[model samples]
Target: MTAKDLESLLTIYKEVVEKIDLGIHVIDSNERTVIYNKKMREIEDMDIDDVLDKNVMDVFHFGPAEESTLLQVLNSGETIPNVKQTYSNNKGQEITTINHTFPIRENGVVIGAVEIAKDITKLEKMIQENVYKKGDTRYTFDQILGNSAALNEAIETSKRATRTTSSVLIVGEIGTGKELFAHSIHNGSSRADNAFLSQNCAALPDTLMETLLFGTAEQAGTEGRPGLFEQANGGTLLLDEIDSLSPALQTKLLKVIQEKKVQREGGTEDLFVDVRILATISEDPIDAIAAGKLRKDLYYRLSVVSIFIPPLRERKEDIDLLTSSFIEKYNHLFGMKVAFIDEEVKSYFQEYNWPGNIRELEHVIEGAMNLMGHEDTISFDHLPIQFRHKSSSSGGSNDLEKIEGLLYQPDKAILPLDDYIHEAETYYITKALQHHDFNVTKTAKALGMSRQNLQYRIRKYNIGKNTHS
Candidate 1:
């Protein structure tokens, strides 16, 4: 081609390259830049005049410590395809890109490399702030109901839990309102207005979970998107089912807690965050540790201020209050006018230990509300047959509870000791029988009494099945 024709072709190519959205860069055998297009300037957040004819690595390495893709290609004489690069440019702006680098060859002799990159920093920022948005928490301390001492103690612990940004470990069974406590703690903290994000450690696999909690450069490109910890910066992150987190994730979490910084899955920079982590596990800490699911050091770090929510069965005295609260909630939810609960229903509730805790109580009330026809009152017929027929506790526990209540009766002082003893024994035996679903063999075994002896007592006391249910 003629010199003028070649010059015209080169100018046209440069214009076309600069017009394209992707970044185009080239270097000669001496590692001096041959091309730095307009899009490359925008991507690096730098000026065109400063970058042209410069070493790509020197210009690209702002604060990033990892080796640059162009540097690797230049040294290895190999073509590197789809290399994810994370770096800050001369403008001090973080940049992420997928680079395709190829060695320029003359008759099979390696000369230089050409790098083509796509800026994904804008896309990542959009995803960080918009798509995977960190939202405001809708839960607070007022949502946790129950005035019983045991429940109150837990609430008070939550109150204290909210006073600091230290990591917390909430231990409770399923449906025990562990998430509520986490929310309350976050909302109560100094960072309440910032952001709140939760991740169920058990809900995701190790690879996905790592990217979600700590973020990854593979998908987000060089300057990757923020993970949950970064997203909840200056706020709180709730890690539910923490015991279910794989060993690898558990180790990363422990490192985050200890170092107060996180390294993304592919990025080299350690991003510091002011996020408070609140981890929850349904199983006991000891059990989780013994089972090798929860690391002991991680447990110690998370439980700097541990809070245990008592199960419904252990805090039976709170049932009446919780039931009333749930009744009101369901009333509004189901658009019902349940102004009162039948005393019979109350008796059934007090007797039926709730294994699912507050959540179960709410569900029961919801089911009852949905089942109610037009009555202004809730009755035994409204309750699920499961709640009515089955005792949440074992026969021995139900009988023991009955005996305790009997001992505390207001008129116990007036009754003769012998009569009181007989009355308590009869009441406990009946409860035992009921708890065992009227199975004489199971009830007798639970009470450590002979089946014949229990039957005799039942017949003598006239403990009919109808009398209990």
Candidate 2:
């Protein structure tokens, strides 16, 4: 290409890099910072002058045993993809990012490196506050609001787990109160006075998970942070969705449980921790193993005291008790005296399959209550459209009459076209959800829209509330 053409291309490349949502940092082979994009400045909370033309080590501090991703790639001339790194800027503010770092080479010789970073500082902090923050667990045996035989059996077994420090694995489907059981076990244990922290394994990438679980060591004037294992010392640490952990992490977890010691992510020193580990899985351990999502040896190690909680479908009898509890809870919160669920609504609840389980049922009740107004009961109409129109035989006449009323009433004020379109879209989506038996994936496919787009519309329109009459 000619010089003018090359200049134009370079200008376009710079513009695109600056406009990109991800943070971009480029450093020479000597680790001198060269290109720091606008997004990178925002992520690191730095200005262009703060980082440009400076050595990376001078701009950002890494732990003694750790190295900058850009430097690592520059030295090795290798690409490192999807790596989560935690470091501090010159201002001593901590930043966490998932980075894809690549070497810039010429004729098989490394010249420089570029790092693409997605800032996850806020996300990491949120997860840490959730799982590593020191606090007393909220749930105990008395608070686990179910009396079904299946649930009670699981509770009894979990209570047994409190008597020993052996690892306990609570297995149940989503919304089956597996975390509740974990908390109850911890509260009932001898170490109740200590911390009870929990982490959802599925909530983070493997790199972040590793660092958060094991922690980082202090080095080179930077402070170190404790991982979950250390934070829960002399207490209980619950790893929810344990099966979501990668094979490598599972093996490391097994070693920690067996050795009763944990080494931080970048630290050479191993710290002994007297933490009782509790874990939960949303599926059968055997099934997870067969599917290659879980490690067999790790399962054996964690399931020393296994407690299985039955799904809401299996324990349908508890629906009344759960329904009453939720109603009372919402009643107190909403300051509305909803006296009962109409028999038809109760019957429909029993007949419809709750793919989302207890959580789904609870949300349904919540949504219905939002539309209750001064009504004394939750009726067929109060139920979300998905549930109200599940059976084709029901609501056909009423739905037709409601649409007719909207279209034919000359005395009614004309609504904005946008409002009419909004209502129509809501009605159509509800019909699609009903046709698909409330399966979001199937409905989204049938509607030729993404599931996320459909979900956004549902929330935006409050589609379930009154179903527009």
Candidate 3:
């Protein structure tokens, strides 16, 4: 390529990065910002001039216990994907984002780091202000879908929980709607008229969490702020991801639960609080205890009313209902008239395990809806590339049947040798794409070819375009 061509290509890449919806921040090994995209500036509420050529720690006021994910990845030379992080900028504006930070390497040596962030600050505020606001939880028992035996049993247990103010521990895998159940319990109880608040134990450092839970005392330079316990007095307080709390914090929490009071940091007096504690742990209490992630005394106290929500794979019968619900939800949100999914796609959903549970199914439906146009129904082709690839790799019966039919049908005309080879190559590449979830880099690695070569073949065969159809 000529110098002018290279320059044009670079310009195009820069424009694409700038215009992308996700915030992109790249830092050198020395921790100086190299590329802070427009979206990143908008997300962080900072000017490019404030970030570019500046140390990330200098720009963001990270506490002593907290570290930037970008810097962590830079030093560890590892990828940290899909992590929810909450931090404040230098101006004290708190920001929440889901970041995928990766280490940039050259010739097998770590050089710098890049972080792609999706800002969720507004989402967090909405949850705190509206969803978990006083007497205004958006979810109730009626909103908990799925009639599977396991789910129904859990629902029954949760319903019983609303009858008493004892601490309840909700145990389940991630994305199992533990918070939804917590909201339902709060809404149904006698304390339903009071404030309902929630805080994720894993989202902040211990010191910050300490202040957030037990308000700080009025000191000479700063004013006193009521914590979630005080704010949620006479109501319900949900401590989400409770297993992430340190033992010391757990002991403090136990004291609050037992004494029905909170003594603010640096304060001498204990304020009485009638807040009912409802905690959620993604792992079983037994497992969490064995793993030393939860205090035994705290576990026993919190499990006065234990509710275990079954994983999606365990409640396979609910997949169809959940899928329909998600479809309806996205249709209204996307303003698309998707009637239903094809039987094959439904079967694929049933057969495949949803590790992310209902949330994953909902996301799959949402993702497929994004790829739709005038189509009223979601077919195999409409499914996300990841789902399609997983289905192919699982060797579904339908796939095997199709292959058997193709081979056994003697009435079908045989193609020339070159034509047959071309068709076979297309099929293999299409399956490879499915297996790799349509990731060009991974597919190339598995196929023993360069990514450029795989892209050329993908274009030549139009692998993803019509294969699903």
Q: Pick by TM-score: which candidate is best? A: 2
lDDT digits (tens) for residues 1-469 of candidate 1: 9999999999999889989877888888888888888888777877877878887766766344666767677778888876667788876678877788888888977777888996656545544553223455778898877767877888898898777788899999998889888888877878777787876776655765776678765442234557788877887888889988888878988999889999887678888998888889998999989999999999999999989998887877777777778878778877777888877567666766677777888888888888889998887667775665464334335465556435567865556778767777888887767655788876675566688888889989888655321
Q: How much lDDT does each candidate structure score?
A: 0.77, 0.82, 0.84
CA lDDT of 292 in candidate 1? 99
- Measured with C-alpha atoms, the lDDT of residue 141 in candidate 1 is 90
Better of 1 and 3 by TM-score: 3
lDDT of 3 by residue, 96-201 (tens): 8767899999999989999999786765564465336685688999999998999999999999999999999999999989989999999889999999898888
- The positional error of residue 87 in candidate 1, measured at the CA in angstroms, is 29
Q: Candidate 3 at residue 2, lDDT?
A: 100
Ranking of all predicted structures according to TM-score, beginning with the best and ending with the worst: 2, 3, 1
lDDT of 2 by residue, 1-469 (tens): 9999999999999999899988999998778988999999999999999998999878889977667889889988889876778899989999988788999988989999999998879667756477644455788898777778998899889888889999998888898888778888888889888988888898888877887888878754345778889988999898989999999999999999999999997689999999998898988899999999999999998889999989887888889888988899899999989989977577667666666778888888998999888998898668776655453324333343464225557877776777766766777778767755677776665465788898888788776643221
Clashing pairs in 2: none
Q: Which stretches of candidate 1 lie over 4 Å from their true place?
A: 1-135, 218-223, 392-469
Global lDDT for candidate 3?
0.84
Per-candidate count of clashing residue pairs (backbone under 3 Å): 2, 0, 1
